[model samples]
Target: MTLKPARGLAVLLCVLSPLAFAQADAVRKPDPNTRVPQGVIHHAATGFPDRIVASPLQAGDAGFAVSWRTSPAVDAPMLEIVVAGDSPDMGTPRQVSSRTQALQTENGDARYHHAVIDGLQADTLYAWRVQGDRTWSAWYHTRTAPAAGAPLTLLYFGDTQNQNTSLTTRVIREAMRHAPDARLALYAGDLVSGGDGEDDNEWAEWFEANDPLTTSMVVAPAPGNHEYFEEFEDTPMERRVLGAHWPLQFALPANGVDEAKETTYWFDYQDVRVAVIDGTSALDLGTAEAQARWLDGVLSGNPRRWSIVLTHQPFHSPRAGRDNVLMREHLLPVIKRHGVDLVLQGHDHTYARRGADAAPTPVFVVSVVGAKQYRLSEQARATMRPVGEDTQLFQVLRFDGGRMRYEARTATGRLYDAFELIDEADGKRLVEVTEGRIDERRCDREATLKGRKDRCWE
Candidate 1:
């Protein structure tokens, strides 16, 4: 079941090698004015896969998708899978072919390979590996989604966009320590600070920081404004487009609006239906109506007991001028009509939660996980409850028979907020579950006088 590189790539490489070598020799003098194309320094193929990731393709069908990166030499990428038993070697491995896409980054040209493994038994643990030209990646294990009505837990993160990956990495690792059994890691976009998604260094740092976690835990991501910005000195802000590397990096489900398939998709894990919407497209690309129609169809046909929506921009912005009025005006009603239980969003760089004033149908939340911080606008403060500024946080959600418990914790793992949703015979209701949460973190005169300047809001 081994895959091979396309003949075209081989031919192109062969035709260009001699000229490339000659150019390299001539450039040895290293003229300061001389310019070299990015990703020109190619590395020799090591015959090993790197940056392996597993994601959900179709939860209803128990399908999981795997993707990894390998050197250019390994044209045909392959995946080996087996059901786990008491020992790692207990089951016979099944080898499957994969689809590979070649991409040129600032470092060099590499191929990203993807494969979707279906017919997996729910709640079963599976061991898998990726094959390089010379060797196979070490076997990694992941568990499939459990049956409906079964209790499940997931980790939620906001924007991880930062100048460096250290802060996001630290927070992710800390979160794993608390919910090690979490089935999936859900992100509300802005995975990197790359304005145009062309910075190879930033992408490398992000992937390196989340290597093994991504290999096992399924990642559900939405696209943020940062993910859409293009990095160009002459390109005006309005001319920015979606990052070029986005579609190449992650293999997400394609069940979304035709124009924004990968960025806008949905998957159901057990009884919870999670829909990721592309807020950037809705706001900037004039794709709002199409997405809205697609969303209505998705919601109308959803059979899951509980529905959760994930988007980059909040319906109610936590920052005054940052409000996504377009999203709120167009998509909010659809969400409310469908009785969405929770809406998790990012992009505000602040934390705020607002349960609908009249009902508990959709509890909206906005949070940040990166080092960047923003003040809670006075308007936001007046609207949302328990607002926080200058903070980095992560959320853990657990769903059981008739209850869902959500906990928001600071990077240090201290509880900052808590709530519960109870689905009873009458209807679903939001209940405050914050008994031991730390006092609301805010900047005040006392804190300023005490020299804890970072705690104060701007």
Candidate 2:
């Protein structure tokens, strides 16, 4: 097929080339096994397919969901899938058509396409590619979520809003270095700096920065406050509404409240139930009550072995004068009653993780991986433990049945913290595995000694 890149590793290397050059000002030795094929577009642009992402469906879903974008929409965007080891160009690869959603942004009109690929065997590896502008993208490898007994791992990030292209790519690359075969890339929120209307450039940068990973790892993004844009601006009363790019950019399962469609949705990926809440819409808009009700139902009787809540703003705010009280009041009860395992969140511009040794409450994690940095407020310094400031971070988690191993790492691939949780027959036990982790990351005396341009902390 015209789309086939020999092993798909060359395109991956090509995508990471910019970051690699940024690191060493030189090209690293290419892998002897990789080959660059023709028709590979190295950067995101009009008429070329970019910003591709995959997401989960039902628990043990036989298939998965993928979304991509292009300018000048193709007449019929298609998906081609083949068994991992099979010749990609040989037999007729299973074909599926995509539904296109056209979006007009500051840059121009871009077409977003969504496709559902199903009827595949469970726990099987597949390489797939998308057709855009009559051109096919590089092959990306993804596997069907394994049945209940299979192993699963996920890479989680807090935010990649500011400096997404340069700095954020470092953390994402480091994350992939640690968990190359991770099944899911979970974002706590603020995936982009949508403080203004959706900037196609930002989305393009986001996808490019993590392109190699997104096409394979698949993303489950939560909506942070930054995801909401001021709609109807210049009116008597301008209101912030959820950015249109969200629902169009991602074809999430429509299992959330009617008020919060793609933003507040949940799905089962292997043995984990991933519930993403739109705290931005809930607190700023009017979806609190509806979402709260829907979340209760979603989590109350969930049958998955593990349940994780992905929200933008964290309830237990480590920063002083910041608390998502409305969200906590509405959703914490449901989480507690359901015995949710982990709550991954972002938007605080810092890192803080709070866990309970004896209590059954969920372990709440607030982290940020972007260039933006914030100091630990007095509330955090006085209360929360395992706090990190002035450092970009990422988390990789491994799940084998009822036990989970978690690691939090820095932008340069240093282990910052490590922990594990085991859901025993009696109850859940939390263990801190901090042997190899570096000391807690905090600003130094120079930070406080520096001027405003490099002020240490807020």
Candidate 3:
């Protein structure tokens, strides 16, 4: 089967056109006086379908959702689908009209369309595309979750925020190269550093970086702090709100807390139940208790064999003088009572992994995929074994009958860290897969008193 790069033509036109550049300049020319000015709209929406992404459904069901963008909110777009076939036509396809929403940005106006398909047979692969703007997107493959107790693979990324199209893009593609059949791409927030009005280009870079992968695998994203900004900035009534592009870019499950619908949601695939918590909204924007209540109800009644928590902030703070204490106070108890197996987090640009303390304890992980890196603190190093600093990495996790295997690889796809969580009779036991791992990468320490410091130290 040909792996056509879906919407490649439209993305190129959006990224490289001179007219798009002129429009970007007209919309948001950065102020030279400001420290970090707004960026131009490099990946403006063309008349064609672009930024196509597939997301997962909730309730442990076997289906997926597709979303895409058009320049001026076309109401006639259709999300066409069929069981994936050998030829390009994808056999005889069935169609459903996409629900459309008008989205306005500083760059201009565009249309966002989404469609949800569920109740299909399990362990099935399907081909789908969006038709609008007098053109059809390239056919792409998406799959339902494998049968229960089957081997399921997923890719987890932390903060693909800055320099995504250039630097973070490779790691993402490398992940697909390593595990091409990965069922989903799960993000622990900060997928793009800019959801603010002036940062539309960053979202474009993100779409371009994910590219073909975004169209294929189901995307499960939680909102990080960067996904929000003040509505009326520098004003008396300014209030922090989720990004406008968020709802338009991805259509996630609305089964979370009523106030923070898609941002705080839960879904199940095979044996694992994944809960996406909006720590940014919970702690920063006064929805902590509501999400906590929702989280408690969801996790307490979770029907899956295992539960994994995906969120922006960590329960255990790694950096000194930085703790999400309020969020932890509200949500950690529920996590413990419910015995969530793994907690995936981002926002610490450094990578740190902390194993469970005892039986039913959750294993915590924080990683970064962006080019930007930070120093791993001494406390983090002490608490979290196998910590890393100034490194960019992506992780591929696989779950089989009784074991969950995780491998963290570099941009070049070399094995840097590995682990296994074995489901025992009592609880899941943590096992570090250490044989093939390369030496732990870290900045050198100062030994001689006047010696030139390593670049990371500086």
Candidate 4:
């Protein structure tokens, strides 16, 4: 498959090379050592649901969607939810029917089940569990989104594709610890390194990294290029396909373009509306116009006070020679017209916060939370100052009535950058709040040498 080069960037099409294709195929192969031993009597053995996650199906959290995995033995799966009380016992559990699918995985065959619990009370704490055959998972508690005008904080992560089980795990745990009250965790795509998205061990490690968090906090994810895979018959790759596990693993809203249904959707939390787009499909396939049309409608009908867009590729590339010109040309106009407050992105391994130069509509930010590091490009330095090269970082964003505060922290919980966006009657203002923060991390010779020793400065 040959992708048309984005404007002024011929290297973007190099991803179709045989070497890159081979490397992608190799990365998707499951590691034998990481696979679960056959006949092991684990939680997945008795149909105990795992990888449990919750998402909003409607605005104001009137409805919630949940998905999980169970053993093959448990064909008929169900979800039981109840309003939590002081006691350990759930009183009068409301049972919801679930749709189940049989999936053939590298480890073995398993059933993925999903159910949407609707008519949930706003701001109410509910305890829920999944039942398969005679086994049931432990009850987990989750709070629905509060009414509009409620203040909330959210955790954002970028490109946790490498070292997902080890380094990524630590970063997520630390971010969660720092913001325990975070209502939702948003991943800017590339959740795993597997290009085909079928590597069982890589998926396992990713789930393990999120262990108990998925059961409680809501997860909003986008698909990166790595989340897609291409299959070849003889020599050259033929068609690009989404990861096999994507649809089965995530139960997102279906309010998106037909080409990218669940992968591209929008949801409203409090006063903010978040629209997720499929950048990979837009760039590789011919779905840019379709997504752009859908995005225009979504933005035009927006009733929320603040609107945000999340995508795998940045509208403005942080690297010198790399830029998603097609994405910018197709989607940036819609974002600007809608007066989006923020645009969160990943796929660039460096850290950059742009749009501070008198941009009133949206603030663009690119960040990373995994070990993969890239040097800041000359274009990035010229366009986006206060950039972090060879750094692993995460962002915590808080949303109030008319103010949004953002803080970027390193792996060790050090403050790297800070800013706030205040919306006034005139327009939005970006306030630099990085007082007493450390200086920007540049890729100097000493840091490059240390990076070779696995000690890159954050």
**Candidate 3 residue-wise lDDT, 339-456, digit = tens:** 8888999988777888666653588889888865666677897888788876788899999988989888888888888888888887778777898777778854431122333223
Q: How good is model 1 by TM-score?
A: 0.85
Runs in model 3 lying further than 4 Å from the true structure: 1-41, 59-61, 88-90, 195-197, 232-238, 444-458
TM-score of 2: 0.86
lDDT of 1 by residue, 229-283 (tens): 6446474644557876688778888889997876899888988998889999998
TM-score of model 4 vs. true structure: 0.86
Q: List RMSD in Å for every model shown.
A: 14.3, 9.8, 10.0, 10.9
Off by over 4 Å in 4: 1-46, 196-198, 233-237, 356-358, 444-458
- Candidate 3 residue 298 C-alpha distance from true site, Å: 1.0
Question: In terms of lDDT, which candidate is stronger, 2 or 3?
Answer: 3
Encode model 2's per-residue lDDT on 85-176: one tens digit a residue.
75546456899999987777766677889998878888888888998776898888888888886889899999888657767888888899
Residue-wise C-alpha lDDT for candidate 4, range 332-405, written one tens digit per residue: 88888788888999988889988834575588989998766776777888888578977778889999998999
Segments of candidate 1 deviating more than 4 angstroms: 1-46, 196-198, 231-238, 443-458
lDDT of 4: 0.80
Model 1 lDDT at residue 319: 77
Q: Please, what is the whole-model Cα lDDT of each candidate in the order they appear?
A: 0.80, 0.79, 0.79, 0.80
- Preferred candidate (TM-score higher): 1 or 3: 3
Model 1 worst lDDT window (10 residues): 28-37
